[model samples]
Target: MDLMARVTAVVGGVMVMLQRVGAPRTQAVGTKPVIPSARKQGIMTLKMPTAKGWASGQLPKTAPGLKVNAFASGLDHPRWIEVLPNGDVLVAEAKEQPNPPKTLMDRATQATMRRARAIGVSANRISLWRDADGDGVAERREVFLEGQNQPFGMALVNGTFYVGNTDGIVAFPYEEGETRLNGPGRKLVEFKPGGHWTRSLIVSPDQSKLYAGVGSLSNIGDQGMQAEEGRAAIWELDLASGAARIFASGLRNPVGMAWEPVTGALWTVVNERDGLGDETPPDYLTSVEEDGFYGWPYCYWGGTVDDRVAQDPQMVSRAITPDYALGGHTASLGLCWMPAGTLPGFSEGMVIGQHGSWNRSVLSGYRLIFVPFENGRPAGPPQDILWGFLSEDEKFSYGRPVGVAIGPDKASLLMADDVGNVIWRITGV
Candidate 1:
């Protein structure tokens, strides 16, 4: 057998061993140290639950006094969501376009992605769902826009609607309650794309600038720093003049971003590096600072040097610690703050949709969680609001939660589940 075949055989054996032994440790949550216990270099554990759709008359379990129901179904990989001023919900139905493998590692990565159901042709469209009668379910669904390059993040400022496509930000003229956008949008800025393709966009509080999160082209800068220009950082764009600049640097894969209502500070959820054992170097939710660096490809969790990379003592010393650690390899993607007085017991907190894990012996995430906030910071332990996406034996998943947003009534929470092709609506009883 050739090298690729031999490697595959070895990894297959390792998966069998892991399934028998179970996870090395229970997942760690919140801001805490995940002590490094390195495994053999270049040998990664693969553990992804097989995707299974919900059974008939089945629904996700929710917290007491809260109800869970499908707001819309049969979507084509709905990944992100945005609510408009006129009570309309916009869903970004997209998937990553497959890339040709150039090396053995590339092929291995693609194999893992396939098992996780993470790779597919892009839908390249956004759909609008309106609940006109104020019922929990959407009464109208229509294609709002189409023919875009893997569009993700979306925003509206004044009369212009902006979309953060994989390669750039584009804008379309829009009016309230309009279901279709016919004209092609003009590009505001271009981005270098390779590794992390999801571009998350949000407008500043003052409405003068837009912020777009562009992740790194490769994990730990394996493609060299030159290939990483204008990536792994958030870019601030001036709405009036179209000028742009880097807002923050050294974040490996920042996905979901939101502004803290009390402090007006920007916050983001970052998917950290892998292969450092199942526990070390946890993924995190942090407050982003202007001109700040959060230690990617060098150090992690503030000053804990990653010996895998060429060490830079000065840069390590300058690294800032994250505000909270979600869990290693959990792939936490969706983030949105709860509007006060929306849900009785869950008001004034942040809702996070963890898309689950693929690099460990056991699964993590795959549910929606709530973290209570006080004085503009996370205050209490994460509360499980919606769960049971994974099977009882943990070998299969009914769905994986992604983007989250407050519903039009401001009382229900909307979650985008890419795997099950369903949008879930959660409301207090």
Candidate 2:
């Protein structure tokens, strides 16, 4: 009874607080958002919308000239998507790894996550979907691989399949059209695991090395720097030698990485830390450089000292300013280079799946967006490609967008909606 009452009280309080929350700041959207003085959050803002699966005959609202349809549905928390050259789709279904609450705040946060459907036993496997015909919708679904420690990213290179398991990178022999991987995969590189667990994998354009994005173990290194060792940075693995090393540092939580075609630069969308005011430092999309620092615990937005973490003025000095702001707490987790004509009116840019915010009073990201790139840099304001995730009253979300990929068809766009358990495909109207 007590547990039920606490959950109920939290849900009820969510409705009350959301009504009084302020709107997202407009100036915080472009190449140079005014970074405001950091105001520590009191009462630790917790405002998660209740998860309500989509109703019958429902669809996400598309942009002016695009249309959206369910490429795949009835999934078990499909969080990321990848496409193979054979035109098969691999959906990485995962969620938060189990962690017992050690403090009162932890318990409260877990309860809130439950109310929001953000807490679930990770499926810990990748499922393959196929569209044998030229249709946009997938006709069959089957398990491709299983028994992983919360796998998120996947890659196929030189006839070998790689799974970015939370603890390490594993490899298995793969054929062109096999729907299932029967043999046990061998681990190539090991990670510490736990903390932020989404290990996104990408192959360098030259196809010489593999890169994986590993997030920090604590919000702001609260658990100490030792725990954060081998974390909060991107790791590069040399396939031939089976050797790995950190490629970049201080990214906080870098989820997606894509090479900007024009400049041959690696770009990523990072989820900035919370507890700061609603818009103190926005999550950003920036070109990542080798051995670069983007300021995790000690600073943010290029040298803005956090003062909360142990001061590292020298490290802060090396922190490179991010290229573009994604609105504070948007939770932009997905990124893919959309070549020109992938969508109408959008040309040569990045598509981001903002999973939305749970702690913000006024929610920031519950939609899929596109930022056009010109000469390897963000050119103008962002454009919403799909929205209407939240309810009319802002009390519920029918679905939340996450990972994104160009569909097997090559011209269409695909996105994972974890809350709704669906993968949306967008194409020209």
Which candidate number has the best lDDT?
Answer: 2
Q: Looking at model 1, how many pairs of residues clash?
A: 0
RMSD values, in order shown: 2.7, 1.9
Best by TM-score: 2
Per residue, candidate 2 scores C-alpha lDDT tens digits across 1-429 of 249437645764764375335534553778889866777765567777888989999999999999999999999999889899989999999888659878777777777787677876889889999999978999989999988889999999999999998899999999999999976689899998978889999998888899999999988999899999999999999888878999999999999989999999999999888877777789999999999988888899998999788898889889999999998888999999999988888888999999987657677799999999998899998999999999977788999999999998778999999999999999999
Candidate 2 has what TM-score? Answer: 0.96
Clashing pairs in 2: none
Alpha carbon deviation, residue 347, candidate 1 (Å): 3.8
The lDDT, on a scale of 0 to 1, for candidate 1 is 0.85
What is residue 115's positional error in candidate 2, in angstroms?
Answer: 1.7
